[model samples]
Target: MTEKPAKLLPPNPTIGVFDSGFGGLTVLRDLLPLIPGARYIYLGDTARLPYGSKSRETIARYAVSSAKFLEEQGADLLCIACNTASALALEDIKQAMPIPVVGVIQPGAEAALATSEASPSTPKSVLVLATTATTQSHAYAQSLNALGLAATEKACPLLVPLVEEGWIDHHVTAEVLRIYLNEAFAEAPNAQTLLLGCTHYPLLQPLIERTLAELNHPMTIIDSAAATAADVAAYFPPNPNGAPATSRFYATDSIEKFQRLGSAFLNQPVSEVHLLDLGG
Candidate 1:
C-alpha cells in the first residue's frame, strides 16, 4: 500500500513588525532568512520616534495604534521590536491586537539565561546595553533576575543616534562605546554575557566585540534582535521549499529617509517605503 503524502501548511503568514523608529529593521533582517516563506510588514513610527522620552501612557497609545494598523493590514502575528515600546507598551499592544504579539525584552533575557546555564560551573551575570527608556523600565533586569541571573542594565543613549547616522565603525562611535562599556563593566564587573538590548546595536556587533576585548572583558554578546527572531520563528513551522519571503516597509515620517537609513539597518536595499501617519 502506498503511504499518504505529508500535509502542507500555507506557504506564508503575514508578519508585522513595529518600532518607534528604523532600528527594528535589524530584527526583520534576521527574521527574513530564518522564515523564508513569510510576508513581512515593517512599520517605523518615525514621526513620533525617540519614544524614550515619551511617558508610558503615551507610548502605549502609540503602540496600540501601530498594532491596530498592522492588524488592519492582515498581519497574522506582530513583533514589537522597539525596546522602549516593548518595555513600556507590550501589554497594551498585546491586549489591543487580535493577533499574537511578541516583544524583544523577554526573549533577550531568556537568551541570556540560557547562555549562563550552558556553563554550569561558573557564576553568570548579564549586562544589558539598551536605550535610556528600556534601562529605566528595568525590563531586562527584571526578566533576567526572575530567572535567577544577576543583571545590570546600562543606558547608551548615544548609540542609537550613532547607528542611525550610519557610523557603525567610526572612530568616534568606537570611543563612545568604549566609554559606555567602561561604565557598564564597572557596574557589573563579573558579567559574563553582554546583551544588546537595542535593535540598532546588532549593526555594531563587531565593534562591540572589539571594545569588549579592549576593556579586557571578553563576554558573550547576545543580539536581542536575533533572539527575538528566533522566538518568533518557534511559532511557525518549517518552510523549506516555500516561496521567497517578501517585505513591505511603512514609515510614519519621511519615506525617503526611511528607505535610505533603513537599508543600513536591514543590510539590504529598501526599495519602496510607504509614508503613514499615526497621528499625534
Candidate 2:
C-alpha cells in the first residue's frame, strides 16, 4: 500500500471577543466579513458596563474574569474589543492567558496613520472620540505619535448610555453628540481627521457625518471597528476552504436586554444569548 500524505487538521477552538458591553458587537459585525469561516464566541459584561468610569484596577479584575470565562469556552484566540480594557489591562490579560491576544487599539491607530499619510495636507491634527477612560488612557495619542501625527482625544461620556438604550436616531441623541463634538472641536480646532474610537459610536455614524457636513469642514472620519476587523482578518489560516464561520453571544446580565439592544449593533435578530455570572 502507498503511504498517505499527512492531512492538515483544522484548529479545534473558537475566537473569543470580549467587551464591557454590547458595544463590542459592533466590532463583531465588522469582523464577520473578514473571517467568514472562523468560529467566534462573544461575551459582553453588561452588568458591569461603562468600564470607562471604573478604576484601572477594577477594569483589570473584570478583564481577568472575562478572559477566564472565554478560556473555559475553548477559545484558542482572544480579542479584547473594548478600548477601556485594551488600554488598562491588555498586558495583564495577555500575560495570564495561554493563547495569543489581540486588541483594537493598535489597529485603530494604524488606520489613523494610514489615513493621515494618504491625505495631501498631512493632517495638522486629528480628533479621537472615545470614552472618558479611553481618552484618559492616551492609547490613541501614543499610537498617533508613533506615526508622527498630532492626535487629540475627546471623551464622549454620555454617548455610551445613549447607544446602549438604542437611541441612535432620537432627537436628543443629536443634541448630545453635538455638544460633545463642539467641545472636542473647540479643544482641537485644526483637527481635520476624526476617529470614532469607541465601537458603539459607529451606530451614530450617520448623525456624526451629518454634523460634520453641517459644520462645512473637510475632515475624514475613521471607523475603528472597520480597521480592527481588517486586523482580525489577517490572522486566519491561509487556505480559503474551511468550515463556515459561526458566532455565539453571552452576557453577564439580562439576555433579553442584550438581544433587544444588540439588534442595533449587530444589524440582525439576535435570537440566542446565554446568561453568565462573572463573580469577581
Candidate 3:
C-alpha cells in the first residue's frame, strides 16, 4: 500500500518591527490597515536610543540583539523601521535574524525614483530630509543614485526633537520647515521628489508640504514610513476578508513613555507595553 504524504503546514505570518524609539510607530500605523491579517510585534530600543549618535559597530550590536529577541518570539519577518539602523545595521540585523528582513531606506528610494521617472518633464533629482546620521551615511543618495536618479540629502536634526515635543502644527515648526526647505531647494533647485528620510518626519508632513508650496517648489513628497509599510505588505498574501491585526508593544526602557509617545505616533491608544531589557 502506498503511504500517505506528510501534511505541510503554512508558516506563521507574524511580523517584527524594530526601531530605536517611538518614531517607528508611524511605520506600524501605516502597516496595520495594509496587512491586517498578520500579527505584529513592535520593539523600541528606548534605553539605548538616538542610534544616530552611536558608532556603526555599536548600532549593529544593539540591532542584532533586538532582531534575535524578535526571532525568539517567533517572528517570520522583520522590518527595520529606524532610519539610522536601516542605514548602518540593516545587513547585520538581516544576517542575525532567521527571517526575511526589509529596511525603510530602499523602499523610500524606490518610491522617489518611481515618482521622478513618472514625470519625465520634471528634473530627475530627489531631495531627502533626514537625521544627521542618515544624511551623513548618504544611504538615500546612494540608493537613489543606484537607480540613476540624482539625490540631495539634507540633515534636519531639529525636526525630530520638535516632532517629539508634539509641535506638529506649531508656527515654530512651520517656520523651521520653511528654513530647511529653502536650504534644501537652494542645494537641489531642480529636485522634483522630496523623500522624508526619517521616520519622525511623517508627523510633520503637512507642514513640510505647506513650506514647499510657499517656496514655490512643488514636488512629490515620499513618506518613507508609509512606503516601507507598503513594500512590506507586498511580501505577504492579501487578507481578502479584511481581518483585524493584533499588535504587541515592547520597549527596552520606560514602558509608560513608550505607550504615551507610541500612541501619539500610531494615532491610536497604545496599551500594555511590556518592558524589555537588552542590557548595556
TM-score of each: 0.95, 0.91, 0.95
Clashes of 3: 0
In order of lDDT, best first, we have 1, 3, 2
Residue 242 shift from truth in candidate 1, angstroms: 0.6
What would you estimate as the lDDT of candidate 1?
0.88
Candidate 3, residues 230-265, lDDT tens digits: the string is: 887777666667568889999999888888788889
User: For every model in order, what is the number of clashing pairs?
Assistant: 0, 0, 0
Superposed Cα deviation of residue 94, candidate 1 (Å): 0.9
Could you tell me which 10 consecutive residues in candidate 3 have the lowest summed lDDT? 1-10
Best by TM-score: 1
- Point out the higher-scoring one by lDDT: 1 or 3: 1
Runs off by more than 4 Å, candidate 3: 1-12
The candidate that achieves the highest lDDT relative to the unseen native structure: 1
Best-to-worst ranking by TM-score = 1, 3, 2
Q: List, residue by residue over 162-263, the lDDT tens digit for candidate 2.
A: 888778888899998888888887889888888889989999999898888877765788888888777766655444565666899999997898999888
Give candidate 1's root-mean-square deviation (CA, Å). 4.9
Residue 50 of model 1, lDDT score: 84
